[model samples]
Target: MPARPDRQSLPYRDCVGIAVFNQQGDVFIGRRKAEGDPEQSAELGAPWQMPQGGIDKGEDPLKAALRELHEETSISAVSLLAEAPEWIYYDLPDDALGIALKGKYRGQRQRWFAFAFTGKDDDIDVLNPGGGKHPAEFDAWRWEKLGRLPSLIVPFKRDAYDKVVEAFADIPRRFNLG
Candidate 1:
């Protein structure tokens, strides 16, 4: 039998996350498409999350965040608010270690950006994001209170989401005021 590789030996994938805040201080979240068997999919309670994706080789983190946001949500009319003070990281749960992230990463280390959404609600479209150049990551999306994000995400990702919320805690409020 082959020996399993140590989880610690695996590296985290570099990624970027985007938090698009609407005029009312709510942030955008999307329901992720279910993966694997029904039983496993059912375990992911409230599977809502902000748009995020891998940093392509040699790509700048800010640009990657914009690209991911556009690819996943088709949102392009936004102004930068702030970037997380430092990278936030999270590990996949035990059951997803060899399956999630295509078995290449232990988890993801992310640089998160906050943006103020400027366009109308009619401008947003998750079904054909990036003009269908990219695969659909979200089945549905909506604006929600920033403080509620951690509770809405999957268990393993809550900590990372917490840090993201903390990092951008004031951006949304300040943006709304100005």
Candidate 2:
């Protein structure tokens, strides 16, 4: 057989993910609004995911996480609980190999944050993110048991979600928020 292509040669995009946990320890998840994505295949399942987005140029990861949270869900009322010590990476599936992330990355290297939701549910306004520089990503959202995160995201991203769950698992007990 010929040599396989080296996926590691490609760079991973720097990104931030937020795990917003309610007082009861449930984390926030959002349903992806299906759109025409030339990068992804139709076979993928598990449209639900936590709030996440790219880290802009020279922007701090925590700042990016907050911005992503607000832009995607209009949620700004949160108290920083913890941050993952290591950045985790996830690779795009075969169908998304070349087109995902604008073909600039093999996958994403994400720094995740754990935040305690400090506001009421009414504070979340997914439909209209104020000012509208970025379009809405989730059509619906809900609080879910944190353990279910790995099974609720796209397959290619499951490992990262698992790591996120593991990294932030102690927050509830450590902070006695639950």
Candidate 3:
């Protein structure tokens, strides 16, 4: 996908992901684990993905993404952009990561925002201090090189992540030297 010349308007249309970048220029990635995801048939047991959620009516994707990051990872280092933003899209795989969704939604179309993590790695907490259910799309995680994240993600989303990585190639140098 070439760069989108038009920016997304309000109501974002669908979901967005928070690409929480750190001082090392790495982005945060999380996992999901729900009742065995029996509904999933694709690589059902493979670890995949990061913090992402649907953008609500009248709600911005960045807000939703940050909320999801906190809800899923208990971190607030993420921050959205005002003008330029990193956006990407994808189609649902025939079986989706080799796991079946057991639902009607085809797949998520996303607008991802990149953030510089000014906090420490120990600050990331998916379980949170209160201990509630993590609204996750992954079960476990580790900071990865932004360029490499796409291939590690489900094959279905590799293209989308590739687009995002391309759009934000300079992301690492943004605030990484502190």
Q: Tell me, by TM-score, which candidate is best.
A: 1
Q: How would you encode candidate 3's per-residue C-alpha lDDT over 71-144 as one tens digit per residue? A: 77777755553212545666555443223333334556787777767677787776551146554445567887
- Please give the lDDT score for candidate 2: 0.85
The whole-model lDDT of each prediction reads 0.86, 0.85, 0.62
Flag clash pairs in model 2.
none
lDDT of 1 at 133: 89
Best by lDDT, which number? Answer: 1
Displacement of residue 65 (Cα, Å) in model 2 is 0.8
For model 3, the superposed segments whose C-alpha errors exceed 4 Å read 1-13, 38-46, 81-87, 96-102, 128-137, 176-178
Which parts of model 2 have CA positions greater than 4 angstroms off?
1-6, 38-41, 131-133
- The residue-by-residue lDDT of candidate 2 on 61-149, one tens digit each, is 99999999999998999999999999999988766766667767888999999999999999887777644656877778999998888
| Candidate 1 lDDT over residue span 1-178, tens digit each | 3354568988999999999999888999988877653312667577789999999999999999989999998899999989899999998887777667877788999999999999998878888889888888788899999899999998889999999989988975676623
RMSDs, each prediction? Answer: 2.3, 3.0, 7.5
- Give the number of colliding residue pairs in candidate 1: 0
lDDT: worst 10-residue window of model 2:
1-10
Q: lDDT of candidate 3 vs native?
A: 0.62
